[model samples]
Target: MALDTAKKSQIIAKFARKSGDTGSTEVQIALLTARISELTEHLKINKKDFSSRLGLLKLVGQRKRLLRYLKATKYDTYAKVVSELGLRDK
Candidate 1:
């Protein structure tokens, strides 16, 4: 149920600042969001997957921290990422 390299690369490419910018906050948040969504879907079908639930919570916390950092350091980029990802309410 983990994300494959191809999917990870796709997220990085879409959210990265440049071609090789994989460690940026935007990219990391995007990757976490993807994993969070995947795990959420997994949980829908497998309610007893406690390990995956923990993982999903961790990813969500990581994403929240990253978004907090981005919002503090670069509001424009943070707004752009949030708008692009459709995560406005959160």
Candidate 2:
């Protein structure tokens, strides 16, 4: 299930680097993480949902790439984001 607008705004606000920063990388990663988690829960109950599983994998890949980029350019912020989201260290 995709995050609603309200939830999306909340995440954006929480991870935003500055006011009205919806398109920043941190916000993007946070949003993807939220979606990834939601899809994970959905898959847990619907084992036969191959389509959702594929989508979930894609989201994970996207989040991974974004995290890699973040770590490359801003290690401090990357570490903060990863820890805040409870993601595994690389």
Candidate 3:
């Protein structure tokens, strides 16, 4: 259950720094978050899907690394993204 182009573009557009800015760290993290959520829901219904579970873990790790990079290199942007995405407890 991969993300379709429309959904991918929506997430990219929301986080993109500029027009057509698909490769930015914010956009990538948002995309991964979306995918991870989708996979998490799938796992809830299909608990035996080990492959998808592994994929979810990989996505989580990647998003964690990206968030760390953003925090180290651009703390303001990291904070902004985290707030906008509603990630992390208050």
**lDDT top scorer:** 2
Which lDDT values do the candidates have, in the order given?
Answer: 0.90, 0.94, 0.92
Q: Is candidate 1 or candidate 3 better by lDDT?
A: 3
Measured over all alpha carbons after superposition, the RMSD of each candidate to the real structure, in angstroms, is 1.1, 0.7, 1.4
Q: Write the per-residue lDDT of candidate 3 for residues 1-90, one digit (tens) a residue.
A: 789999999999899999989999999999998898899999999999999999899998899999999999999999999999889933
Q: Candidate 1: which stretches are off by over 4 Å? A: none
Please list all clashing residue pairs in model 3, or write none if there are none.
none
What TM-score would each prediction reach against the true structure?
A: 0.93, 0.96, 0.94
Give the per-residue lDDT digits (tens) of candidate 1, residues 1-90: 778999999989998888899999999888888888899998999999999899888888899989999999999999999998889645
lDDT of 3 at 7: 97
Candidate 3 TM-score versus the reference: 0.94
Superposed model 2: Cα runs more than 4 Å off: none
Q: Judged by TM-score relative to the true structure, which candidate is superior, 2 or 3?
A: 2
Q: After superposition, how far is residue 1 of candidate 2 from its true place, in Å?
A: 1.2
Candidate 3, poorest ten consecutive residues by summed lDDT: 81-90
Of the candidates numbered 1 and 3, which has the greater TM-score value? 3
